[model samples]
Target: MDDVHAVRKPRDSWWTVFLVDPVACRLTLLVADRTAITPNGLTGVSMALGVTAAISFALGQLAAGAALFYLSFMVDCTDGKIARLKGTGTPFGLWVDYMGDRIRVICCAAGLASGQYAVTGDVAYILLGAGVTVLDLFRYVNAPQMKRVREVVRENRAQREPAGEHLARQDPAGENRVPCDPGPAEVAAVLNEAAALIREASAQPHPGAHRVLRLYRRIGRFLGRHRVRPHLMSGIEFHAAVFVAAPLLGSWALLPVSTGAGALLLLNEIFLIYVLWLSTRTAPASPIPQRLPV
Candidate 1:
């Protein structure tokens, strides 16, 4: 029981921990278990809500847009919770979720720009929207590459561990090397579990692939702890900020604000590129596995 408690992933976001998880995710989990609603169904609803939110913003209904956008985000959070709890996630589900998120970003950003342009006649807002779109595209594109790098690291680490060591003892480079939060002890336990899974996957590729794929779903949870996460524009932080600003800033202020945010996100993309480069460059020269065709 203590080991089980020790291996549970820690919440990385205050918003998710204090608000979204306790309220939105739990409510969705209840509804999901009691109803016929599938996770993909939730994803579809989220997509519609996001598109509607964008349209509402374009029509200058800031309050409605903000509410709708929040609803979309809530459902987006719920679907993954449902997927994990129900063991229903698949490679196809991941692709759908990925596409849905991108669609929301594009539609919402474009709508905000259109509305702002209508109100102020500034072409710069259009450029801002384009920039957000580009950054979002890059973010999604980078995720698979990051996963590939992790797989390489996992494989390399597996090869380096002593042949007769226990799985729990075979910590790859030690969790201390990663500078984890939530104190060292809890992070150490989680990394042990992660290392065990990685090593097992490396040893037995057939059943291990499924196990690793299941573990891969938690990649976002792990990567959320990366030093560069807070700076990324195409993430929950920026998404929440956009919703909050929509109602408070209105069209006139929102465009310029979002433009600045998008610029920051673009800069973060460069940082992510550098991080990926470092990982791949330092990784052992093993052929990367073909990523899920998402």
Candidate 2:
């Protein structure tokens, strides 16, 4: 089992050559050892390095800062690849990954804001901070609600255990039941399907679903394109393009009004984050068209 969880492998993207993918190169070096680090350990280390990078940037070191920050991004992707290669993905591990990423992102934003203040000593720093603070505050305030939503998801699927809560061994009779059993893709699929079923069943008697369906029709009264937007293909790409690239671009180079532009763009991301959060919270799950697992 340990060997299975620690096996080295490649993915469909398959950029194993060090020269081809420098990011993957750095990560592959970490995995080249006789043993591999656990996913959560990788995430934690990544967060630490990312935080250091952000702090350095905030302190106004550009070149070294960029290299470290980029390394952070490499580690972020590497952990996911390691999980995929070894099939060691666990709910607890994923939750840790998500939390670590969120913290790193927030720190980066804060670092940028601080850097602006340190560099310019202008009132614009206050504005930038305000925008970032708003987004951070919103996420902080909503985290509990999100936790509850996840819990609801678990309970809806008849999970007595908390979502992402790792279970310790429970002995029945003379036999050991299990110890820290964490499943991968198939387990996730089953849980998601079960949750979907619960959602479908729960909504069966609700008249609100019908009214919501009608509203969707009314909203789509105009013609539309079914093609996915350049902005929406993947969440990471969308978020990175909007939040990181747009804001930090001007700050990194001596471009015309780059820092100013980054500040304004940061504000837009705060608004975007709020909208996406609300959309997820209020989204009505349509009548599931698929059959339930028997």
Candidate 3:
């Protein structure tokens, strides 16, 4: 619906919000709404364009590859927006979108590396391509699982907390609260539970999470008044910016830019793996309560 697009700003990367969404995705969505085209169809188009972009890069057409890559991403963004607008989103569509994203990244990276290899005759470019693909794939897979776990924890907490208590805290001004959504207390509980799950899952005691949580709290405090989510480094945004700039730098530079992106992704993957390891660890034995005198 138009409502979805009109309300709060999309909680996506800033690049998406400013660079792609307003003009590109919106225009594409407009055309799609008027035509018989479906979201899945758009997704397929995106995939095809991405493959072509990759091939173009492999053949040493950096500018064409970059243009096609950007267009592909724009169409990819359009499919989801159009689906949400038309109320035509499906589980199958979601799956296709996810897989398409992965495949696109793989193709693009491989093409860039292949092109670089052609230029320099280095086999490391091939390995660099594999690293990029693996890093992006891990991000796609792990981030969602972590998010889902947090959601489950929040839902559990919301069911446990009293409605009046939530109303008193989050809706103290008597504003109408959305009945379907959880409140602040519930969200806080969900975060706590997610942290606990991470601690439990770790093989050894880890203080890194604790330090990160403190920083997270500080950012939360700063953003609480603005009601805006904090922006952080994201692989999606990183790669987007890289690809958008790579063509301008010429073919030889694309390799170094992509390799740098891959390195960043690897670091991010490490952080994610640490958190995931904590989430899967067994919780310590519960302490027994001592008897109190009557």
Distance from true location, Cα of 247 in model 3, Å:
3.2
Candidates 1 and 3 compared by lDDT, better number: 3
Sorted on TM-score, highest at the top, how do the candidates line up?
A: 3, 1, 2
Residue range 92-144, candidate 3, lDDT tens digits: 99889988988888898889778878988988878877777777776666665
lDDT of 3: 0.63
Q: Which lDDT tens digits does candidate 2 get at residues 55-137?
A: 87588665555566556666766776677766778989878897777777667666766776788876565565455545445
Residue 108 C-alpha lDDT in model 3: 87
Q: What does candidate 1's lDDT look like per residue over 1-294, in tens digits?
A: 232223223433434444455556556647655897877989999999999999987887777887888788778777876776666778898789878988998898888778777987888878867876776676666655555555655566456666654345455555422222331112223333443444455544345433433453355446546422122344555665665464566655665666676666666556445444443443345454534454
User: Which ranges in model 3 have alpha carbons more than 4 Å from their true place?
Assistant: 1-4, 7-9, 144-211, 217-231, 273-294
Clash pairs (backbone) in predicted model 1: none
Task: Show where candidate 2 strays beyond 4 Å.
Answer: 1-22, 25-33, 129-235, 238-294
lDDT of each: 0.60, 0.46, 0.63
Stretches of model 1 off by over 4 angstroms after superposition: 1-15, 149-174, 177-234, 280-294
Clashes of 3: 7
Better of 1 and 3 by TM-score: 3
Ranked candidates, highest lDDT first:
3, 1, 2
Better of 1 and 2 by TM-score: 1
TM-scores of the models, in the order given: 0.66, 0.47, 0.70
State the displacement of the C-alpha of residue 50, model 3, in Å, after optimal TM-score superposition. 0.6
